[model samples]
Target: MSTEVAQNTLSSLLEAVQPPNGGRNIHDPATGELVARAPEHGTEELDAAVAAARAAQAAWAARSHGERSEFLNRAADAIEASAEALAELLSREQGKPLNGPNARFEVGACASWLRATAALDLQPEVLVDDATSHAELHYRPLGVIGAIGPWNWPMMISVWQLAPSLRMGNTVVMKPSEYTPLSVLALAAVINTELPDGVLTVVSGGREVGERLAAHPGIDKVMFTGSTATGKAIIRSSADTVKRLTLELGGNDAGIVLEDADPRAIAEDLFWGAFINTGQTCAALKRLYVPESIYDEVCDALVEVARLMPMGNGLDENNVLGPLQNKAQFDIVARLVDEARAAGARVLIGGNPVDDQPGYFYPTTLVADIANDNSLVVEEQFGPALPIIRYSTLDDAIAMANGLDVGLGASVWSSDPAQARQVAARIQAGSVWINKHGAIDPRVPFGGTKQSGYGLEFGVDGLKALGAPQVIS
Candidate 1:
């Protein structure tokens, strides 16, 4: 669609929409002021959206795979067509670098996921047979799926839930975090036109709305991506209905630099892995355990490289680090740094928030001499803060790396491939990159263990999360 036509369509779609309880203000992180207002959907609107989804479920499920595929393709096309506007809005609201590869990749990946899911045929079918009787397995949609997505990758994660569920014939009622709702809302406006009116609904509200949706008896499955504490509450809320769930919670992911690893090369990877998106990513490397042999060298390299990267508004292409999305994040990052310094950890680089910026902006911080028990070492900072803990032996390093309760992702750096792979295998994370960090593919299943929450988000395992296997004789 042309830009003018798309803008007109979006404006019309949003006309009657006033912000969930009445209207809510959206802030531009760079200015820390209200830039837009989103209409809040009240109980009545929430009920209607859910009912509409439930009402459309059967017909959507009954559509031939080919028919469903076409709709998904259309949605993908619409998303790609609106990528520029969506990316700008996303960067402004979510506080991520707009020109960086991450933002563009996120937009493109949304389209790719839609197309990929469209091609998948997740349907009921016979699986086994016997002499006297025949057995069959069937895959069926789970009525209405309630997805509570995080602000970090709002549009991408929204599509992650919507694509698979819709492909498997389930209707979705998605709730994006209030901090970054604009991107997903814009996305909804684009794709909603291509599908049945109620097949995909975006509910804009805060914790109350999310709590209502999670505990609501009508929702069949609840897929949430956020903090571990919230995930626990969601799990408890859904217990009564035994709602199927896929929770991708927080991670205190670790990066281990082996004695043989090149300090310069590994330091660059570590900086981007931990500092990208201001270190807000769940799978971002937050803790580093390095061999004492190269501890000083690695720390020095990180400091030198980090100083060269600019920090400013995400819209500025030169800015490698952006502000924290909101006040809560800003506070958390500040407290973590302060506490770490008090605990005797040496601040090797940036450690304080930039005072001149309107938004919550923290400097890229690296602290050495961190103890495992310190808050910065144990907790998921979710900011541009890196804590380095030194170890003398490989065994000690592995033990320290696996000490955290989170097991979402980790990275092991080494020049020896065999040694690195061995170390990678021992780490308790779902994904371990030998020489890289935060490397992900749609074909690979991504998730966590322990407190990081359960169930996979992508790959073939992701398909299983959307539907159920049935056996017939």
Candidate 2:
């Protein structure tokens, strides 16, 4: 379809969405342009969507896995075909770089996830094969899933929620975060066109809509990806209905660079680790612990790479990093960094919003010599500023790393892979990497520990999270 026609189609879908919390303008954070107006839908609309999903779910569930896989494959094909348009929409709405690996990576991930989920098959397992008795384990679909997605990687994260639910034969009524709902609505339209009505629905909204979805009796499961505070609220709201929940909450991930690590060799990876997607990622390396022996060297190396990386509006293809996804996030980054600086932290590279920029464009920042109690070191900044903490002993570093209540992901960098792996085992996180941080695969299970979240979201284990186990004899 022509760009104008495609845009009109997206506009029609946005108009049709029933935002319950009333209406709000969706702006491109990178350019501060009004892109779309979204309604924060309320309980009535949520109920209607859930009921429709309930009606359509059984038929969807009854379809053979192969048949359902076909639908998912078709949706994947559609996404891949529209990768550019979707990436543009994502960049405009979510504020990630359109050309550089930001928006395109997320859009491509959606298509990849659908295709990967379709490729998976959950076969029945035979537990007993005696002469006279036989037992087999079967995976049965949940009727409907209520998905509440976050804004950091809107399109990709929704796919993380929806693809598995669809593969396991469940319908979904999803609410994208209020700040960036346009691309999600557009994505839902693409998927819904290939599948049966009500199989997947996107209703963009804020807190009220999320609460309604979590509490709705018709929703068999609620899979949420956002803050820990919100996840706790979802648990409380869903308790009365006994709804199944899978929450991917906030994370204050820590990365430890070993004393023996080559500062120059890991500099680029380290830069991307902390600032990928402008550091809005839940599993982004928010805190870095380095031995005092090489602390300044590591800082200098990171600055050299980060200073050279392109930072600008997402519409500019050459820019690698765009603005924070929203103003609140940008402010959070600013406040945390400012607080750290006031507390005697040294800014090695940057700690300011781009001057004269209309967007929420905070520069990639690195702070050093911050105390342990500094909020920039303690809390999940979820933005572009990263605090580098120096530790004289590895024991002290491990203690500080494992001391946090939020444990989503952690990484250990060392030239000796064995030592790194051993150290990684001590980090209290759902996933730990020997050298890389936040690198995930569709075949590997990914989630968080402590209050980060409960339940997993990828791999065979994740697919099974959307279904119930039945044994027949």
Candidate 3:
């Protein structure tokens, strides 16, 4: 899309969601400027959306998978056409810069993921093909899906939940994070243009509405991405109804650097892995375990890289990092970093937030010489602060990395591919990268192992997660 067209589309989407009269006010985290007001929907609104989705599911499911795939492809096309507008709005609301793997990249990922999901084939498997008896395992849509998304990577994660659900012929009623409703609303509006009415709806409501939706009899399944605390609540709410769930929850991910790894060579990737989205990512590397031999070298290299990366208003094209999406998150990050500082952790780069800054802009901080038991090292800071812990042996490093309760993702960095893979295998996480961290793809399956939450998402398994399996004989 052209610049003028994109701007026009963004303006229209903003105006449509923000009626002059009502709704909750939303501000840009990067600048504290009024971006727009999202519709403050309540339980009544959620119930209506769920009803609409329930009414639409059978007809949607009745269509052949090929027919559904065609609609998804069209949705992808619409998203691509509105990609720039979506990215601009996402940057403003979610506090991610348009540059780098932040806003624009997220919007692009939404489209690509949709297309990739559409292309995936989930054919029924033949259990037995003998002349006397033949059986086949098939999947069917599970009515309406209640999809709850997070503030960080709002658009992309919503796509991660909804695309496959829709492909499997399940209608979806999405409740976006209170922190970022406009982005998801706009995204759903664009997608709804291609889909049949009531097939997909967005209920931009609060906590009560989400709770009701999880327990609502109409909703057959719930897909959530957020904190482990909330994930537990959803699990309990959905228990009585026995609603199927696919949760991608909280993660205190770790990254391990072997003695043989070159500090300078891997520093840039390590920096991005931890600091992406200003380090608000669930699967982002929160703790770093480095051998005592190269610990100082790694810290220096990370400090060198972190200082160069610009942190400013998301609207500024030059700035790659932005503020925490909300004050609560800002407080959490600030408190943890402060606690780490008080405990004598060496602040190699940034540990201070500019008091005069208008927005929730916590500076990019790298805390080194920190013990494994330090609050910053043990807890999921979910901010731009990274705690680098020193260890003596590879076994100790691995143990420290796996000590956390939550394990969504982890990484092992080494020169040798075999060594990296072997080390990666030992880390307790849903997904582990050999030399990279949080490099997720649509084609691959992803989920957490322990407290990180369960039920797989993405790829064929993700599609199946949205469906009801049956064996035909």
Per-candidate TM-scores read 0.94, 0.95, 0.98
Model 1, 52-77: lDDT tens per residue? Answer: 99999999999977888888998888
Q: Note each model's CA RMSD in angstroms.
A: 2.6, 2.9, 2.2
Best prediction by lDDT = 3
Ranking by TM-score: 3, 2, 1
Score each candidate by Cα lDDT. Answer: 0.84, 0.87, 0.91
For lDDT, candidate 1 versus 2, the one ahead is: 2
**Lowest summed-lDDT stretch of 10 residues in model 1?**
1-10
> In lDDT terms, how accurate is model 3?
0.91
Q: With candidate 3 superimposed using the best TM-score fit, by how many Å does residue 397's alpha carbon deviate from the native?
A: 0.9
Sort all candidates by lDDT, best to worst.
3, 2, 1
Candidate 3, run of 10 with poorest lDDT = 1-10
**Against the hidden true structure, what lDDT does model 2 obtain?**
0.87
Report the C-alpha displacement of residue 376, candidate 3, in angstroms.
0.5
- Provide the lowest-lDDT 10-residue window in model 2: 1-10
Q: Which candidate is the best by TM-score?
A: 3
Candidate 3: tens digits of C-alpha lDDT, residues 1-473: 22221223888889767757789989998788889989988999898988889888889999998999988888887888888888999999999999998999998999899999999989999999987999999998888999999999999999998999999999999999999999999998888778899999999989998999899999999999999999999999999999999989999999999999999999999999999999999989899999989989999999999989999988899999999999999999999999998999989888888999788999999998898999998889999999999999999999999998888999999999998989888889999987788999888999998999999999999999999999999
